[model samples]
Target chain A: MIFYVVIFSILALLLVASGLYAIIQKDLLYAVISTGVISLILSVMFYLLQAPDVALTEAAIGVALTTVIFVITIRNTTRFEDENDNNKVK
Target chain B: MFGDYQNVVTMSVYGSSIALILIGLYGVLIKKHLMKIVIGLSVVDSGVNLMFVAVGYIKGGTAPIFSPSVIDSKPLMVDPVPQALVLTAIVIGFAVTAVALSLVIRLFKHHNTARIDQIKSLKW
Candidate 1:
């Protein structure tokens, strides 16, 4: 019982840490990758929570498809988020 | 309170999922880049999906499957309904993300920028 609690606690902390990392990341590509990490950890947690089906779906879609589409979009647009324009004088 | 060992596990799952949702909400609400907004939305989806499964999970529960080996352990199987629902949610989330990204691409093309504030002030 305590073992399960320990594992859950660690995974939970990791999830929140990665989430914060995703939000604060300056590089769009890195932010997307962090989101993928979130998905990866989530899939593991799903399996631990006794939902293998959901875990597999998350692994396939969240970890793979979502990140791919976002990467492709970033490739077409901008890799780094440009925040310099908000302060420019008109 | 973390007095009980079981509560720790349950609280961990619930707390983390909620934290993820909040972090994503912050990203969506405060971020200027269109890509960041999309990322935030997807994170929120993940958080919700996790919460769904967590809500359905039972302590020491087995996978909700029917097998001859476990003919008598039916009562220990985890709830399957939330799993099915989360499956659908995950797929729909993927579709939504694809559509959102495509829209971001279009916005970038039309406005030549991905910043939300800039896109807002400029002619589309």
Candidate 2:
């Protein structure tokens, strides 16, 4: 009903906002965190959509495992995305 | 009230998922950093998964689970096939992500840089 509509719209907007943040953020760590946030919201949406299996899998993998790997990769490399020298060459 | 209420609500899922996919594509094609490219790929995977699950939603449907209380609602259950397929897709996406990130790490270590433009030894 009204409740479903309200929640769905909000979740949908949040998903997009976080997705954009992950794409455009300057810091690699923040971008990684935003990706995790996107996954968390997606899991909830899966549950609301009556797919508990998907919700469970997403919660475990997307929120936890994927974020962990991304962070580890960032930790081993540069945290901030350096744009000056790289873009100048192209 | 909105005309055709269910469709309107579900429309948000479709629209946003498509937007996410486009945003991911932008990151992949435009970003110079290796990590950003990988993140974009992951976002694209999520968008696809979301769209698939959203497509399976049925009006007035219940979760496709078994119990003594809901035996009469078999036809009213949301599509379980997509749920199963998406489950496998999620796991496979994780594996693909792990492999891609590992490759990124290898490339970074070899070149001492994570920016894609700087790695030119492999370029033809």
Q: Which docking category, incorrect, acceptable, medium or high, applies to candidate 2?
A: medium
Per-residue CA lDDT of candidate 2, range B31-51, in tens?
999999999999999999999
Interface Cα RMSD, each model = 2.5, 1.9
User: Looking at model 1 chain B, which ten-residue stretch has the lowest summed lDDT?
Assistant: B1-10
Q: Rate the local accuracy (lDDT) of all candidates.
A: 0.87, 0.90
Residue B120 C-alpha lDDT in model 1: 64
Determine which window of 10 residues in candidate 2 chain B has minimal summed lDDT: B1-10
Query: Residue B89's C-alpha lDDT in candidate 2?
Result: 99
**lDDT digits (tens) for residues A1-90 of candidate 1:** 667778899999999999999989887788889999999999999989988888898999889988899899988988887656333522
Interface RMSD of 2: 1.9
CA lDDT, candidate 1, residue B34 = 88
Instruction: Please tell me the interface RMSD, in Å, for model 1.
Output: 2.5
